[model samples]
Target: MSKQADSSICAYAYCSHEQTGYEKHFFITPASLLQHVQKLDELGYFLEDITCMQVKEGFLLTYHFNRWEKPGRLALRVLVVEEDKTIDSISSIYPGALWHERECYDFFGIVFKNHPSLIPLLLPPEMEERPLLKSSEKLRDLYELLPGCEQVLHAPRDEEFGQFIKECSQKGK
Candidate 1:
């Protein structure tokens, strides 16, 4: 028989007013991050979604929960440094989270610890850059020159589009 990597565990639940009384439930601390995932087998909450957002500080892990009686589901967050963008995986909690986490990893380049399979859920094989991280002007230029450039070239010339172009141009892209 093989021994599991974890030997200790802790669990805590806290409420946040910002969650509007739904209680932003979480089982935190480094110790529990691994073992508590096993408890989820008996607890019944299933992983719903995983995504990353680029903020002023760094990428934020957003883990959504479902299949639980608790209202507002749950969101377990983990922060990573801009340089050391990685996290211990919770795949043991809900296997389905693997796909979601992989997609997040693909786009944001965050690591999921202990994930059995961590691979791209999107993006082509030949892609050389992370498209979402591109500057606004580069995005505009790419979209403006996409396959159907002719339709985009003749679309309604709204003032909002002009404003977008002006911003991109001023940003020195």
Candidate 2:
């Protein structure tokens, strides 16, 4: 793989080029999420949708972006620690992200900071608990649900993924 591809793959714990048939996925930190999205926007990538997954460590947020002209998709994954449960909103960069982020918030209880209006998109506004929050015991590991994610899951954080990839690359050398 090219260095760029290797870096992208190593950035995320559960990234897979095969998962969504996307070209690549970069696991990013919550702090860098906006910067990534902004860069993609400048590259003319449109926001497709944002999906959230509840995990043992926290909620995994995936922002799917694609370019119509080039026809390539990229998934940017960010893990928000459970206690914090928040991340910067990309709605400013991609206006479409607003609705998707709201929906994610409605179902996963993730707060998108600076979102113009982060209200419930699908459920009743009064609902207290997010319907999609699952217990860790009931939640299956990413590898179990997505084949090819086994290696990815072993390093659940972005930093760990980077270190794992670095070690693997050095060994191959």
Candidate 3:
């Protein structure tokens, strides 16, 4: 589906530490989650949203970004099976994704490749099981914008950190 029609795609203020141009609207998708990260590495877009999703089949890995050198917001996503919840680490590209990946692993049981250290960032040492997979209530609020959604600022943001299952539901299966 086109991002404009997809409720999972939303427009927001793209803020980043890098010195970029004016913020631009961006689309979010489970399919493009991973591709966008790879694109950012190649295109020099600053990291925007680095989070994962819970899908019926499994999980969706993503990294959102705003282009500092260009003019656009980028969102990347990748779907992973429950049995093999893993993906390549983007630390090589963004350097900062290292901690983000670790946080994903700590809470959602995602495995990152070639990470210098993928230790727990927000979970206790005794918490062995994946917290996000444990319950549906701990999901992030999923959202997408309709075309011409100039009133994007009114949407309520999901602040809960343990909303893994909610992220996956945006798949619209």
Better of 1 and 3 by lDDT: 3
| Model 3: per-residue Cα lDDT over 66-157, one tens digit each | 64544454444355667877677778777888888888898788888788888888888778988667455554333321233333323312
Task: Choose the strongest candidate by TM-score.
Answer: 2
lDDT per residue, candidate 1, 3-111, as tens digits? 2223121111223334223233342333344554454444555666777766534555656655445434445544455787778887766778788877877787778
* Model 3 vs. true fold: TM: 0.57
Ranking by lDDT: 2, 3, 1
Best-first order by TM-score: 2, 3, 1
Every model's Cα RMSD, please?
A: 20.5, 7.1, 12.1
In candidate 2, what are the lDDT values of residues 27-62, reduced to their tens digit?
A: 667776786667667666788889999876677788
Number of the top candidate by lDDT? 2
How many clashing pairs per prediction, in order? 0, 0, 14
lDDT of every predicted structure (CA atoms)? 0.52, 0.71, 0.54
Cα deviation of 1, candidate 2, in Å:
13
Per-model TM against the reference: 0.56, 0.74, 0.57
Q: Which stretches of model 2 miss by more than 4 angstroms?
A: 1-20, 143-173
